[model samples]
Target: MINISYDIKEYRKQLFDIVNDGNVIVELGCHVGNTTKLILDKFDNVKIIAIDNSPEAVGKMEKLADDYSNLTFISGDVRRHEILLEAFRLTQSCDILSVDLGGGYHPDTVFKVFYIWSSTFKPVHSIIRNKGLVDFCNSAVVGCEDFKSHEGHLESYIDEGIPPQIKEFELWTPSLREK
Candidate 1:
């Protein structure tokens, strides 16, 4: 049995509830198939496409794939828009897209990368053409003034001594879309 953390369980519930029956789900930065397993269990009919850049992570995902028939694991960088576009092309418009990328410190660089990658593919907006859902977790504004006070931690965003860029896109959230 998989040992799911409370935080991850909540995220899984959110994702599972949003996806329609038999819809497609794309999980970016799937590490070790933990969340992927949860998704598979929650939505048995849904097709899951999990992507991770690390070879080790991909190997782990492949091992888990043996038990789950609905899952397809791919090794690639989600930051590369072309790669993600190609992956999405293989399936129908996604009903749910979960982003768990930028797992490192150095919020400035990570935020910039996130913006670049997000702009390349508007997953939240694009996937929900006919009303879908996108769940973006563990994301923070890299060079924001507020983040500067944040301490450097493994999962927390680390603010380097860099000011925010003028052209930065404000981080997108479910609430933001409503208002």
Candidate 2:
């Protein structure tokens, strides 16, 4: 159970709840290994392949990974195609894909990478950050069911079912999922 005082604790708890034993999780932006530590403490038999661009962040994750043998930290920008490809090569597939890149200058870039990651790996679940990105993905990412964490809370979106492949038409136009 995530009992931390951080506002995102409940969100992390919700994410952890979906995780099962022996599951492989790919985390896009693991800053300081806070969430990674939580997941390690909670899941005993899970493998977490996490990536971060900053050396400082990767160092923190490295320290955390030393304690848990199940963690593998990659030091590189996850937004880069080469890095993402490397991540895919390392993990092969994932049960849950957790992305929280802290809303960079181009949110679209994050979505684009997510689209690529989702299409290639086809994760069973994805819990992404921010309202606008969540809104964008709901329509753009195929096989996405409109899921609200709680009533009137619009900061994130969680898809529990298996993801579908990207469509040709969605690549050309922007669409929002209608409630």
Candidate 3:
């Protein structure tokens, strides 16, 4: 999932291209608020709940959140059930749910956690960090288009178009599933 063309600016543009006004964005791994800043800057009336494992990252986002009233920051590991529950309580459905949990875990493993947590409410679109995980997710949930950051680079995937909304969102807890 490494692409030389994967600059932060391009990443911001790609995210902005998919997200529009009034869309809720739940982002995993909000490192230093680079993407979070762009998201807030690009869209007005948008709600973004960004989470990161590091306190430093959250602190940085906290500084940025001061300027943008629509943004919220949560400091916790997204892989944790309680953290996911916190994110769920914040927003049930989002136009886009972007995830990049870093390289510590396998892409499949990361995708699985996100899938299980997000099973209740399907996002209108999703932006996954790895291409393989995107394929894996597409199998579990159909009709998402595979997109590349650059013309020939396939580091990520963007699930395009509108998806059906959920009436009752399902919430998962640690005891309910094996860790």
Candidate 4:
């Protein structure tokens, strides 16, 4: 299992409140299942689908799933829309989508995956009502760069007159929250 330094309990609590009980949850780049374990412990009723491209990470995640039956691990890349589509097809709808792809210090891969996922999955206003949350724990400079990139991209989409698919978006740093 991955050893995370931050206090994940608060994020777990926020997720629980946003998703309630018996909702489907999807996690991208779930390395070693640390956050996945926290989610399962906090929201036992919800079904969790965790994906990681690395075999090593998937292996770690599989070990973490050994005792828990509610969690399912998928070994695939989130960059592939088909993979995400297939996963979403299996679950139909997800109440929460946690994106924690490995983009430490630099976010080229993270930006690509987030844009693809956001474009592919149209937020179903009735079923998946809550806005998706992204947790990025790294250097302040890197986080700020990601925030600016996301903000600019989102604005471009808005300027194109694209209907707001995402109800709301929350970008969080280790200590501060960026709108």
Q: Name the best candidate (by lDDT).
A: 2
Alpha-carbon lDDT of model 1: 0.51
lDDT of 4 by residue, 68-118 (tens): 888888888776545765675666445566666653513545554554444
Ranked by lDDT, the better of candidates 2 and 4 is 2
TM-score of every candidate: 0.54, 0.68, 0.66, 0.57
lDDT agreement with native, every candidate? 0.51, 0.63, 0.62, 0.53
Model 2 C-alpha lDDT versus the unseen true structure: 0.63
Candidate 3 lDDT, 29-117, residue by residue in tens: 78788778877876788999988988679668888888888998888877665777687677766677777665354775665655544
Error of 1 at 123 (Å): 5.7
TM-score of 1: 0.54
TM-score of 4: 0.57
lDDT of 2 by residue, 1-179 (tens): 11111236555866777789898888877878888888888789999998888767866888888888999898887655567667766765688777767544256655655655654455777666544554555557556666543211122423222123433222211111121
Candidate 3, residue 57: the lDDT equals 94
Tell me how far the alpha carbon of residue 20 in candidate 2 is from the true structure, in angstroms, after superposition: 1.2
RMSD values for the candidates in order, in angstroms, are 11.9, 9.5, 9.3, 11.2
User: How many residue pairs clash in all the candidates, one count each?
Assistant: 0, 0, 0, 0
